[model samples]
Target: MTDDKTLVSRVLQGDMQAFRLLIGQHERLVAHMIGRLVKNNEEREELCQDVFLKVYEKLSDFSFQSKLSTWVATIAYRHAINWMRKRKMPMTDLAEEDHFKAAFVEEENPESLLSDQDMNGFVMTLVDALPPQYKTILTLYHVDAMSYDEIGQVTGLPEGTVKSYLFRARNLLKEKVKKCIGKEELL
Candidate 1:
C-alpha cells in the first residue's frame, strides 16, 4: 500500500489514481463532518464535493502540521460554516439562546412507545434535532475519536471551548435520550 506522503506526492505529480485514492481515504471523514453540519441531503452532497475540491486546491499548502484527516476535517468544517453564512442561516450560539428553557415540550408522542431498536433511532433523531454546533462537536469528538485539541483545530475553537461544547452537547443529548426512553433515572 502506498503511504500517504507517497500518494500525496503522486497526486501532486498529476496522478488521477493517486488523487482518487486520497479522496477514497478521506471521503468518509468529510461526509461525517458535512452530514452532521448540513441537514439538507442535496446540500450536504454538494458541500462534500466542494470540500474535496477545496482540499485539492489547497493541497499544496498542506504543511503536515497535523494529521491528514485533521487537515481534511478543518477544510470540511470551514466550508460548511461558510456555506451556512452565505445562506444567511443563523449559526447556533448558546448565548443567543435561552438555555434555561426547555428545547422541546415533552408531548405524548409515539416515540415514547418504540421498541429498543426504534428507541435507538429515536435517540439519533433527537441528536439530529440538536443545533449544528452540538451535532458537529459530538460527531467530531466521539465518533471521529478526536481529542478536544483536534476538534478545536478542526473547528478553529479554543480547546476549552471545545471541551465545554462537548460537555454541553452530551448533557443535552442525555436529557433528550432520557426523555425519549421515559427513564429520568438514567441520567
Candidate 2:
C-alpha cells in the first residue's frame, strides 16, 4: 500500500494504475457515505461514479491538510447532500423524534426482544429513517470509524456540532429501538 502522498503524486503524474488504485482504495468509503442517503440502487451506483469523477478532476486542488480518505469523504458527503437537495428531501427535520420519544417514555424495559443480528438490522433501519445530516454523521463516525474532527472535515461541521449531532442521533436511535421493542413485545 503506497502512502497517500506517493499515490497522489503518481496519479498527478498521469499514472492510470495509480488512479485506479485510488478508486479501489476509496470506493467503499464513497459507497458507504452515499449508500446511507440514497435508497435507489441504480442512483447510488451513479452517484458513486460521479463522486470518483469529481475526485479525479479535483485531485490537483487537494491541499493535503487532511487525510486523503477524509478529502474523498468530503466529496462523497457533498454529492449526497446535493443530490438530496435536488430531490427536495428534508435534510435536518426531526419530525419523528416526538413520536419516538412518546413511545420510549411509555415503554418499560425493552432490550430483550432482539438477538444481536436482528438488533443490528433493526438499528440500521432506524438509522435509515433519520434525517440526512444525522444519518451522515452517524455513518461517518460509526461505520467509517472517523473521529469527530474528521467527521467535521467531511461534513463541514464544527467539531462541537459534530459531537452534538452524534449524541442526538444515538439518543434518537435508542428511543426508537426501545419503542420498537415495546411494540414487538405487544405483538
Candidate 3:
C-alpha cells in the first residue's frame, strides 16, 4: 500500500506524479468530507477544489506529525466550516427528542436492497435539514466514517465534543425526518 506518508513526502519533494496520486487517493474523500459541511452544490464543489488547492499549497508545511489523510481532512473541515460560518450558519447540537431510532427511521425490510436508494434519499433530506454543525458532524461520521478523534482534530473540537455534536445532529435529523413522514401521511 502506498501509505499517506510516502505519498505526502514524495509530493512535497516536487514529484508531480506523486501529486496526481495523492489527489486521486484523496479527492473523493475530501469532497465527501467537505460536502457535509456546505449545502450548496456548486459552492460545495468549489470549496472542494479550494480544499485541495489549500492542501497543495500547504504541502510543504506538512511535517508528517499526523497522517496525510488527517492533515488533508483537517484542511477540508476547517475550510468547510469557514464557508458555513461565512454564510452565517454555524453548527449546533440538536435536542434529544430526535436521537432515538424510532423518531427518524424505523427498521426496514432486511432483504430489500431495492429500497436502499429511496431510503438513502430520505435520509439525505433529513441530513440536509440539520443545522450546519449537526450536518457537518453527521456527514463526517456517516459519510466519511471518520473516528471521533479524527473529527475532533479536523473541527478543532475535543473528541468528546465531536461525539456530542454527532449525537445531537442525529437527533435533529431524526426529528426532521419524523416530521416529514408525519406530514406526508397527513396529506
Candidate 4:
C-alpha cells in the first residue's frame, strides 16, 4: 500500500484515483466524527460528502502538521458544527446536565439488568441521550483513539477542555450505566 505522502503527492498532481484512495482511507474517521455530531442519517451522509469535498479543495494547504485522519476529522467536525449552527440547533444543552444528574441520583439494581441480553443496546440508548458535544468528544477519544490534543484540534477546544469533557463524559456514561445495572461497577 502506498503511504499517505505518496497518495497525497499523487493527488496533488491531479490524480483522481489518489483522491479516491484518500477518501477511502479516511472515510471511517470522517463518518465516526460526523455520526457522533449529526443525528439525522440523510444529513450525516450529505455532510460526510461535503467534508471530503472540502478536504479535496483544501488539500494543497494541508501542511502535514497532523495525521491525515486528524485533518479530515477536523474538517468533518467543523462541517457538522456549521450545519447545526445554520439550523439553529444547540450543540450542547445545559439543561441536559441537570437531567443526567437526576437520573444518576435515582436508585436501581444492577443484578436485574445483568439478566437482559441486550445490555449493549441499552447502553447505546443512554449514550444517545447525552449532549452532542459529549458524544463527539467521547467518540473521538474512545472510538477513534485520538489524543486529547487531536480532539482539541478537531473540535476547536483547548487540550484541557477536551480532557475535562472526556473525563466528564465517561463519568456520565458510568453513572448512567450504574443506574441501569444497579451499581455493579459499570465502568
List runs of model 1 lying over 4 Å from the truth. 96-113, 184-187
Over 1-187, each residue of candidate 3 has an lDDT whose tens digit, in order, gives 5888788888888898998888888888788777766767889889988988899899989887767787898898889877767877734544533333332344553224235567677677567656656777788788878888877877788988888889877666655555555444322
Candidate with top TM-score is 1
User: On TM-score, who's better, 1 or 4?
Assistant: 1
How displaced is residue 61 in candidate 4, in Å? 0.4
The C-alpha TM-scores of every prediction are 0.88, 0.85, 0.76, 0.86
> CA lDDT of 19 in candidate 2?
97
Off by over 4 Å in 3: 87-117, 182-187
TM-score of 4: 0.86
Cα lDDT tens digits, model 2, 2-28, are 999999999999999999999999999
Query: Candidate 2 — which pairs collide?
Result: none
RMSD to the true structure for each prediction, in A, is: 2.5, 4.8, 6.4, 3.2
Candidate 1 structure quality by residue, lDDT tens digits, 1-187? 6777887788889999998999999999999999887888999999999998988898888888888889999999999989989999877675543432244565746354465447656666666667778778988987889988899899999999888888888888786667566687766
Off by over 4 Å in 4: 93-96, 99-117
- For every model in order, what is the number of clashing pairs? 0, 0, 3, 4
Q: Per TM-score, what order, best first?
A: 1, 4, 2, 3
Q: Compare candidates 1 and 3 on TM-score and give the better one.
A: 1
lDDT of each: 0.81, 0.85, 0.73, 0.81
Cα error, residue 174 of model 3, in Å, equals 2.7
